[model samples]
Target chain A: DVKVTQSSRYLVKRTGEKVFLECVQDMDHENMFWYRQDPGLGLRLIYFSYDVKMKEKGDIPEGYSVSREKKERFSLILESASTNQTSMYLCASSPPYLATQYFGPGTRLTVL
Target chain B: SQQGEEDPQALSIQEGENATMNCSYKTSINNLQWYRQNSGRGLVHLILIRSNEREKHSGRLRVTLDTSKKSSSLLITASRAADTASYFCATDSGDDMRFGAGTRLTVKP
Candidate 1:
């Protein structure tokens, strides 16, 4: 079975603070993605990395950045956290050429 | 706007019944996948059907795809209380995958 692990299940941060959410996969997948899920708005992609050091912006990438220094890990960075950024953050990984994604337990973030 | 849209945003059914969810997309896709998300949890991949394929089944779950109509349907037979969850449909358009808002299902015991 594939395992995707997130660094935190819940987090709280003050406004303008920098926040980091980490995700690691044991399946050695080549693609890693970050998304924020909101009620009624659905799951919107923040960023996705196809390979180490390679990143691509999704539909909503504002105020967020991602790092993929290694294959097994991916990190999402909140440049300046704001209340509007408070939501559930999801991390997913999939092997190359496969659209089947394995997701980690989400991190519920609160920017107060 | 490659995001798929699921019909009947929410549905409630009695156990032992069948529940069906429909998904419609705007663009062509390489494949379509279904996922189930328990409350406040990550999504679990349920089934994946490629564009060329018509129907596939895994246990009690049956998925049918219609490329010409740009639609797909998921049927869960003999639904149980444990089958209650949010079902999302995703479209893989070769570049990236886009997800829908999802249909929330509730199975009454």
Candidate 2:
């Protein structure tokens, strides 16, 4: 069974603080993604990594950055957390050439 | 930008009834997928239909895709209370996949 695990199920941070959300997958997938879910925005991709040390920005990547130093781990970093960044953060991974992405339980981030 | 948009943002149905939701995308896609998310949980991959295919089915879920119209539909038969969740449609193009604002389904027992 493919499993994706997030570092935290919930988190709260103050404005201007740095935040990090981690995701790990056991399936050795080549593609990993980060997204933020809002009430009306759905899942908007923040960043994606196709291979180790390779990253691509999605539609909304201005306030976030990503790290993929290894194949099994992907991390999302917020330079300066703001209230507007508070949302349900999700991580997903998929095998090479596969469109089906397995997701980890989201982290509900609250930036106060 | 969002690629897919689902119609009927919210739906309410009773147990044993069939529920249907529609999704329309703006661009050509390689494949379309359906996902379900229970409250406060991660999204679960439900089904995937390639652009060349018209319909596919799982236990109680049926998905139909229309490439020419750039749209798709998902039908859940004999929906139970456990089926209540937010259903999302996603389109895959190249290496990128985008999701639509989901349709929240409420099944009243």
Candidate 3:
């Protein structure tokens, strides 16, 4: 079984704070994705990385950045957290050519 | 937009009955996958069917894909109360990925 683990399950931060969310996948998948799950809006992609140090913006990448320094680790960074950034964040990984993604447990961030 | 759209946003059924959810997409896809997300959590991959495949099954889940119609359907047989969750269909157009709004299914006990 593949396991994807997130650094935090829940977090709270003040406005304009910098927030970091980390994800690690044991499967060593080549593709990693970050998404924000919101009510009514569903899951919208934030950013995706195909390889180490390579990242691409998804549908909703504003105010968010990502880093892939290693194969098993992916990080999501919020430059300046705002109340609108409060939502459930999900991290997923997939094999090079496969579309089936294995997701982490998710981090619910609350911006005050 | 490449985002898929699921029909019948919400459905409630009694346990032991079958639950069906449908998904339709706008663009050509290489494959379509179904995922289930529990309340306040991440999604779980349920099944995947390629564009060339018609139907596939796993456990009590049945998935059917029709490329001509750009649609897919998922059927859960003998559903249980634990089956209550939001079901999403994601489409893969080569390197791009998009997910639908999802159908919230409630299987009453």
For all candidates listed, what's the TM-score of chain B alone?
A: 0.98, 0.98, 0.97
Give lDDT tens digits, candidate 2, residues B1-109: 7899998899999999999999999898999999999999999999999999999999999999999999999999999999999999999987589899999999999
lDDT digits (tens) for residues A21-45 of candidate 3: 9999999799999999887777899
Q: List the residue pairs that clash in candidate 2.
A: none
Q: Chain A TM-score per model, please list them.
A: 0.99, 0.99, 0.98
Candidate-wise lDDT, in order: 0.95, 0.96, 0.94
Which residue ranges in model 3 land beyond 4 Å of their true spot?
Answer: none
lDDT of 2: 0.96
DockQ of 2: 0.88
Interface RMSD for each predicted structure: 1.4, 0.6, 1.6
Candidate closer to the true structure by DockQ (higher is better), 1 or 2:
2
**Candidate 1, superposed: residue stretches over 4 Å from native:** none
For residues B1-109, write the lDDT of model 1, one tens digit per residue: 3389998899999999999999999898999999999999999999999999999999999999999999999999999999999999999999889999999999999
**For model 3, what is the alpha-carbon lDDT of residue B106?**
96
Question: Clashing pairs in model 3?
Answer: none
> Which 10 consecutive positions of candidate 3 chain B have the poorest summed lDDT?
B1-10
Kindly report the docking quality category of candidate 3: medium
